[model samples]
Target: MRYDFLIIGSGITGTMIARELSKYDAKTIVLEKENDAANHATSANSAIIHSGYDPDPGSLKAKLNVEGNLLYDVLEKELDIPLYNNGAFMVAHDKDEEGLLQRYYERAKTNGVPGVEILDQQQARALEKNLADDVTKVLNLPSTKVTYPWEVAIAALENAVDNGVSFAKNKQVVSITADNEGYTVKTEDGTTYHTRYVINAAGAYTEKIAKMIEKKVPYHITPRKGEYMILDRRVAGFIQRTLYPTPDEKGKGILMVPQYHGNILIGPNSEHQASLDDVSTSKGGLKIVKEGALKLAKNIPFHKNIRTFSGVRASSSHKDFYIKESLEHSGFIHVAGIDSPGLTAAPAIAKYVVDTIIRPKETLIDNKTFNPCRKAITLYDDMSAEEKSVAFQSDARYGNLVCKCERVTEGDIVRHIHRSVNADSVKAVKKRSRAGAGLCQGGYCEHQVIKILAREFGKTPLEINYFSDQSNILKNETKVKK
Candidate 1:
């Protein structure tokens, strides 16, 4: 079928693009390779909304970081997702490193950031007491923040759909043929997409897609992997704010981050890779994460370590966000080379692409009836006693506590499934409903979650995911005579 726009890759970049198009009168569709949005690097990111502090001067990262940071307050309200502007602190360990931190603060000011401040060690200690007494200085980026990445991605896609954009899951595009009218995209499932525009937002494989075109874009992409460790919320008391250490030539060094989930996250050591599939965690990476956490976190206990995961960044050799379109083919655009503050830049980048690349003069009508607000997840604890009693009576599943670690009930799991929750992978469910992400880490709830998935998704017990490898929980099935 024909669509005005075909966005390949349902990561934050693609999702945001879809949202931008939804504001106009355009037929848009986002094609995701996985079962749902954000199953790739989007689901596994460190969830830091950068303050436009890093990146070299005069780079896209610097420009878009400022623009993207400005939209958080409005976007959070529209999407109904949790956006925590807890701010950040780049703590200097010694007197010698203090000057470097100040330089970063200056960069933020140069970029038109309003609240960037320089604090002495004593002032920093007043803000966060857990800092080591020997600390030299700290940079307070008050606009720094964190958010649930998956929530933002999903909400954007949903809002785009509400404003008229279709989402095709398991639609992995393999090849694109640009023609006089548009491009014909052939997916792995033999589905064909004939669209006026092609957006190559495919995160890791963006370079591969570029090579598919005859006039391939001049670009280079390298995978930079970052691994992280999540500390239990109980350990959050040890953290006064996001902690940081000195940086080297490679990238941002390991540090402690307070995630939106009310837990402390650390590590994410940057490792460059030649291929996208090379994303994996190693004991060496974990060692850096833990040791660095201890050094940066003056009071966080190591016993709080609960989980470890890694995400790969599509680093470009040019150190800038790459957005290119074919001079011969107007509709074919490459939103590649998106790294670092790409998450923060996503919304702004979407608007920029629509204005500069698409230039849909005909479809410039603003959506008058667009419902920007989405319903937040219902929390049982938030309801009053009478409300809980009524809710439990309406659906007994609401009272059935299935996941003890997170106080998740059967009703919560059902809502996730009915909402088209992405559960093809265990991580998908964890991101969607916090099912297996609690303290027990699925040790007590794995079987229960599998059973629910089997019943909801119409899969056999063995068909449900058991681990990251997509292994089934049920070892065997029995056939009995009636």
Candidate 2:
């Protein structure tokens, strides 16, 4: 197939870039190696919307993060994604930590961060009553927020498709060769796609993608694996705002994020890994996470942790995010070095690429009729007294609960499965609908979702998958018994 542009990843950056480019009249195609968007780093992180307080002054991360934070209000409304400005509290342990925080406060001031201030122990405690008493000092970033990283990516990518962008899932780009006017990319599935431009948004493999074009991309991605713990909805209101630790040379300390739903997330142990694919949480890493969580709230009850998992960050080999045009190659752009603030910086990055890269092109034409709004299903929590009556009267599936833990309705799961690519995997469905993200994890609805998959895709429940290519489910009725 021919395309004006070919994107090399399905992570958030690729998805957002596709969404950005779709505002024009270009024919684009996004290739995802995985069955779903945000399967790697996008969905793996803690979902923190950073407030541009940590990166070095005037860096790409700083500029983009600051701009991205401001863009969320309109972006969320236009995209129909949920966002919570749960504010972050960076607590200090002692005078030494307080001294370090002073530097960060100054840096934030220099970066023009709004709502950056120091709060006494009493003030911090009042902000979040569950904070440990020893938190004598705190830096309050009132602009800090939380969002569903996976949902944003999914919506953006599908929105791009709605605007004429094509998607080719399971089409892993194995090699790239430059041609007379453009590039020819070959996938593992033996199909070839030709495009004039290529964008490297592969999270951990961004460097590898550049190597395909024989350009020596300088950044090295170190995998920083972060293990997270999800508490039950009953513990959602334990803290009124997100909590963080003071920034230092060791990197930003652990964080407590309040999800948009009535639940809490504790986690993201930052440990460097040797392999890019080493996203598995180690025993020691999780122990550190538990200890960190207890430090914030001693009553967090690690026993209530129904989910423990990890995601690898494409940690910058250098200092800041690298989003620049390749001097060595034309039509090749680098979007590597996306770490903690990448999600917050994504929208700004999209704008930057558009202005610096796309707008200058002679062929690029603006569609005056472009509509940024997307029609997403926001009825999960939007069902008020009147809306519930109207919905339930129209469909019985809305009343049938499939995931009791997350309050996911049968209708929600069915729609998510139909909308999501390769709707056979539990992991795929979760990324789309938050199906198993609640207290019981998948213990309550994994079987039910598999049955739904069986009915939708004409497969037996036994053949259903925990995730793509990971099926080991036991057949409900044994053939030997029959």
Candidate 3:
């Protein structure tokens, strides 16, 4: 396909850029290597929207984080995504750590982060009663928030697609060649895309994509893995706010996060990995996470843990976000090495790329039909009694419960299955409708989901995949169909 802009990777960075570009009159497409959007780091993480106090004062991470944090107020309403400004507490267990809290407070002020204050031990304990007894001080960042990171990326892409942006899944870029006319990008599936400007937002493999045109790229990416555990909603009110340890060189240490949903999240122990694909959780890593969580809060019911997962971060050697037009290639822009604060900084970074990097190079007229709003899926549990009765009258599927764990009705699953982006796989449906995200972790509802997907897509149960094309859920028919 020929286009004006071709964005690689459909993570938060790429999708946000696509949404931003959708406002302009241009032929733009986002190519995602995976079968679904946000299949990597965007899908798995702490989901914390950092308040911009941690990064170095003059760095891009700090600048964009604060700017992007402010954008969520509008984004939450426009996109219909859930956002909780429950705030965060950086606990100090000793006098030395209290000194560090003061330093962070000063940095927060310089970074233009509002509502930052230091609370005494009594004040901190009063707010979060479960806090460890040794806590000497606390840095309260009221601007810090929690959200569904994958939902943000999904909503952005959906909105962009609604406004005339094209999205192609499993289109991994294999090679790139530049010419006077434009650039040619070929994928592994033998499809080729010709575009005038290429935005490289390939996440962990961004440096490799940059090196495709230039042997000596400016930056390098080191994939670092972080492991986490999700506690059931029974522990929802166990911690009122996200709790963190003092900042360290490795990154913000393990945190106890109260998710936007009723669940609680804890233990994202950072560890550098030799390979980007190594997201397997380890006993040692979980142990580190458990130990770290205990320091900030007491009597954490580890038995309530529902799930354990990990995500690899595209940690750049430069120690900051690497966003700029390629020096060797004129039209190629690299949005790489986005790690800790990347999620929070995505909106600002997208604006910068579209306005600063791409606009000056070409004449982009406004897309008169551009629409920023993408209605959220119908959540059965959030409906009022009258609304539920009306919905049930319209579609009998609303009366059928597919996921009792999460109160996900068959109607919810079907609606998300046919969205602008569409949920083709079981995991995709789970991410969209929350059918399999509850305490049982799909154990009770997965088969029902599989059957519903099969019915909706006109495929046999055997043909349905758990996630990607290869990971089929039902291996074979146990007994021959009667």
After superposition on all CA atoms, what RMSD does each candidate show versus the true structure?
A: 2.2, 2.2, 1.1
Question: Any runs in candidate 2 off by more than 4 Å, and if so which?
Answer: 379-382, 420-424, 460-463, 469-477, 480-482
88-187 per-residue lDDT for model 2 (tens digits): 8888889998997798899888777898999998878777888987788888888988888888888888788877788887678999988987889999
The regions of model 3 sitting more than 4 angstroms off are none
Order of models, best TM-score first: 3, 1, 2
- Candidate 3 matches the true fold with a TM-score of 0.98
Top candidate by TM-score: 3
| Ranking of all candidate structures by their lDDT, best first | 3, 2, 1
- For each candidate in turn, the TM-score is 0.94, 0.94, 0.98
CA lDDT of each prediction against the hidden true structure: 0.80, 0.80, 0.92
User: How many clashing pairs does model 3 include?
Assistant: 0
lDDT of 3 by residue, 139-250 (tens): 9999999999999999999999999999999788999999777899999999988999899999999988998887678888999999999999888899998999998888
Tens digit per residue, CA lDDT, model 1, 241-267: 677776778787887888877788887
Candidate 2 at residue 128, lDDT?
82
